[model samples]
Target: MRLHILGICGTFMGGVAALARELGDVVEGSDANVYPPMSTQLEALGISLKQDYRAEHLQPAPDLVVVGNAMVRGNPAVEYMLDRQLRYISGPQWLGEKLLADREVLAVAGTHGKTTTTSLLAHLLESAGLAPGFLVGGVPGNFGVSARLGQGRHFVIEADEYDTAFFDKRSKFVHYRPRIAILNNLEYDHADIFPDVAAIQRQFHHLVRTVPGNGRLIVNAHDAYLAEVLAMGCWTPVETFGIGQGDWRATLVEADGSVFTVHRGDELIGEVSWPLLGNHSVMNALAALAAAVAAGADPRVLLPAFATFESVKRRMEVVGEIGGVRVYDDFAHHPTAIAATLAGLRAKVGKARILVALEPRSNSMRLGAHAQALAPSLADADAVIFLHRPELPWDARHVTDALNGRGTTAASVDALIASLRDQAQAGDHVVFMSNGGFEGAPRRFVDALRP
Candidate 1:
């Protein structure tokens, strides 16, 4: 089969392209903003890339055109596919039909924690020598590739709730047909599409509807939202996990550096001392263990892998650190994600002055919801700096006063950079948190702080 993928430079699309090649399908793709990582990866895989979308690029009609969600309607390639009546499938749809079919899939689904949980599960399986093939939204340091084709039948996937492509408005996870699905905490997100939390819940309900009767649904017992979903009746059996006692429980056993431990339902189900720390991370590990168990891997097999598993590329990725000031970048744009990220850094860095550089970039955050929680989330930090661009409607003055009232110094990043340029203090952690790349804030932070 020949596959022409649109917007193939994204992490998800890159994985799809790789899967196509591994399955012996001739692959070609195009993206407008092609850059490192994906570009280098695609070339290494020997897949051809078209810089721009053109009707001619679809020459001779590939067997299927996998369209990325980022490629919206009216795109030349998309329109051409439709006008010519050429069959097209979304990236997720293609993956489900071509790769995941007949495989035991362990899917991690939630408004948050999908990437972390998927990486943890993949690494956990690897620790047990399961060597499961996996696909994650972000690049897991443990595995060089976002998606890999391997010998194992157990496939771990980061199942997201975001709607699929422009044509298919259903959530992407609906197609994965998870044999073991982890329902991590659900919340109101993607405000641009989902009007409220209930709407998101409905999409999750759809995913639950598809799980096979013998499949397992691992849910956060503490999430009242998920509780409502389960109360509605499920076709598959459900297992619950949380900080408190349940079928599977999350207990923080220990922490040193990035590694941490979890005690499942009173028994120590091995340690997860990852390069991550937080209640949310604890939840992520719990979900991974549950899914691993469902996939026939021992829950205890993940401990060693957890220690060596570096987090995903942008989720708390430390670009560089100079002197005592450390700069971090993370793809945390939602309110819950931002709060969790700040909390994790606070736990790791101790009492160092934490300066938060944030961009309100996601569909939900770009508008506003955590207006109140924003200051408190950063309250652990000594100072907070917001880098609002010209178009975003965020009012820095309100955020400034809120943090100031909470006894934290607040300023704009541009201003903070100018003020801190002379010298970086001995104990300071500059944590830059955002879903979108903050236009080199990590680099700029180093340049401004280096003495």
Candidate 2:
């Protein structure tokens, strides 16, 4: 089938384009502001990408049009589809019809670890000779492509609870039809739609309802919310995993640098070490392991693959270092994610001056709903530099002070970069952590340090 997608530059939309191409679909797409990496990925798949959305860009009647959740009714292609009475669906819904329905789908869902967990599941299955098809939001360094269509029976995907699209208000994962659902963790997010934690929980419940009776549910036993959900009991077979004892649990053996191991666990049917850091990553690994096992991947076959796994891009990704003060970037905007990332960095490097550069850029974060969570998340940093100059939904200064007055400074990006350059010395870790690009602050910061 031929397909045209709107807003295909997003990581997930680009992934859909790749998946569509691999599945023998003639795929094309348009985005308002197309940029690197994803644009390159789409082009490599031979998927046509138009820079700006135009109604005319819709070519001779395609079988379907996949609309990204970010694309609204105002988009030209979207409007054209409606006016022409052409068939159109959300990206996830298209994927559900073409790839997920009836097939064994190992879905990783959470506020933070979904990408890593999904990527880990893909890696484990591929190594086990499953050649598993996958669609992950972020590019896993292990697989050059974010989405791949293979002959294997398994389909692994990142199951986000975010809204599907303007037309479909349901969670995107609701369309995935997961057979083995990994509920990594849940928290209040996507403030645009959700009023609080309970609202997000309902979205997750909707996803759980999609799983078949034969399917299995593996949840973070440690997450109080997921724990509560499990107590209520859904129809599918359920298992638990986390720091606490459960069906699949991870006890950290050692974390020397960004390397750690599950000291013990029966879910893998064997004890094995992983090459990623943080308690969060360990939990993600366990979630992936459970999903892989549920999909019939041999515990032994995938165990060895974990040792050679490389970290994904922008999750503690060090882009450059000058005179020992490293400039790194991460896509952690949620308070939980930000805190976990900082903790991981702290464990990897010792006693170094860890400067936490922050931006409240995510839909929920930008609105400052989680203002209370901001301070404690940055406690790991030696200093906190927050960008809240243009305007803040609330007083960011007061929030920083609430955490601690010392070493907290709120400045514009330019001023923050200047301050970092002036104070940067050997052994300092300059972390630019935000979901968005933070206005290219990472590149600008590195350029400032270059002699």
Candidate 3:
């Protein structure tokens, strides 16, 4: 089958394209914004990629059109497809109907940590000889490719709460129908789509409704929003995980979250010392472990895999360390995730200066939904450079002012990098945080730091 995917540069859509190509389908795609890891992966697969959503790209009309959530009604390609009455389906629906139907699907879903948890779960299962197929949101360091069709019957996916497409308002995870689902943690996000936290929880409950009675739900024990979600209604067996609470627990052996001991109820599983930092990461590890056990992998066998597990790209990825200064590229847009990441780094570095280069790029951030909480989230950072682009509809000064003399605003990526370089010192850790391609600011800053 020949398939044309719209907005294929997105991580999830790109994974779908990779799976389609692996299934012997002729896959070609187009996107308005194409960059980095996802684009690189697609190129390596030898799939054809066209820039932008021009109507000309869909002229020949492939066997089917897989529309990404980013696609809207007014997009040139979308309008053309609709006018011609071309057969079309959302990426999530296509993936569910075609690839995941026969597999023992294990879905990792939440507002955060979904990528890492999904990657870790797949890795644990793979290490234990399960050979599970997976479609991670980012390029996991352990597996260079984001998606694959494995020999085993299990398929692990990073399930998202985002709507399937402009045409399909239902959350993407509703279509996955996984036997094992992890509700990592939930908070208010995606301000463009969801009106409030309760609305998002409603969608999560929809996903909950799809899991069979025999399936299992791996939940965060400390997350009040998720607890409320379960209160809505639950049919599957529930297993919770947290640092000091829940069915599966972790004890912080290291303040930076690099080392932790796992517990499954009264029984001690083992200690896991890994490179990932932050309490959020520990929670992710515990969730993955519980989910793996649910899928029939022994915890003892999976413990060793943690030592070798490499996290997904751009999730606190160290791009460079030069002249005693370490630079990290992170995909953290929400206030909660930002605070957790900074706190972990603060613990690791002690009194060392921590500088942050933040880009308010996500739909929520750009819309000023998280403005009031942004400054408080950066409390751990010694100094911060916020990229306050003119196109952003909100006044960034509100956030900067609340930083208590620690925050400064830059109008462009270049300015942001320069400000960080000026403030950075030896033994300092500089983190670049954003969900989108911040105009290649992270690597550019690393290059600038090169004396």
lDDT of 3 at 364: 95
What lDDT tens digits, residue by residue, belong to model 1 across residues 1-451? 8899999997888988998898899999999867766888888999999898888999889988999998887889888999999989899998898889978898889988888788888888888878788888878888888888778788988898988999899999998998899999898888788888889889999998989899999999889999888777798988888775667875555542354445666677655565677778877877778878877876665566666877888877887778867777778777678777777777777777777777776777777766666766676767666765666676655776877643322245566566544334767776677776566667787876656
Question: In candidate 2, how many Å is residue 449 off?
Answer: 1.6
| Best-performing candidate as measured by lDDT | 3
lDDT of 3 by residue, 1-451 (tens): 9999999999999999999999999999999877877888898898999999988999798889999999998899999999999999999999999999999999999999999999999999999999999999999888899999999999999999999999999999999999999999999999999999999999999999999999999999999999999999999999999999999999999989999999899999999988888899999999999999999999998998999999989999999998888999999999999999999889888999999999999999999999999999999998888999889898999998888898899999988888888888889999999999999988898899898
Best to worst by TM-score, what's the order?
A: 3, 2, 1
Off by over 4 Å in 2: 59-63, 255-271, 389-391, 406-412
* Local distance difference test values of all predictions, in order: 0.79, 0.81, 0.93
Model 1's C-alpha root-mean-square deviation from the true structure amounts to 2.7
Clash pairs of candidate 1?
258-274, 259-273, 259-274, 260-273
- On the 0 to 100 scale, the lDDT of residue 282 in model 3 is 95
How much does candidate 2 score in TM-score? 0.93
lDDT by residue (tens digit), candidate 2, 145-238: 8888878888899988889999889999988888899998988889998998888888888888878899999888888998766656589998
**TM-score of every model versus the real structure:** 0.92, 0.93, 0.99
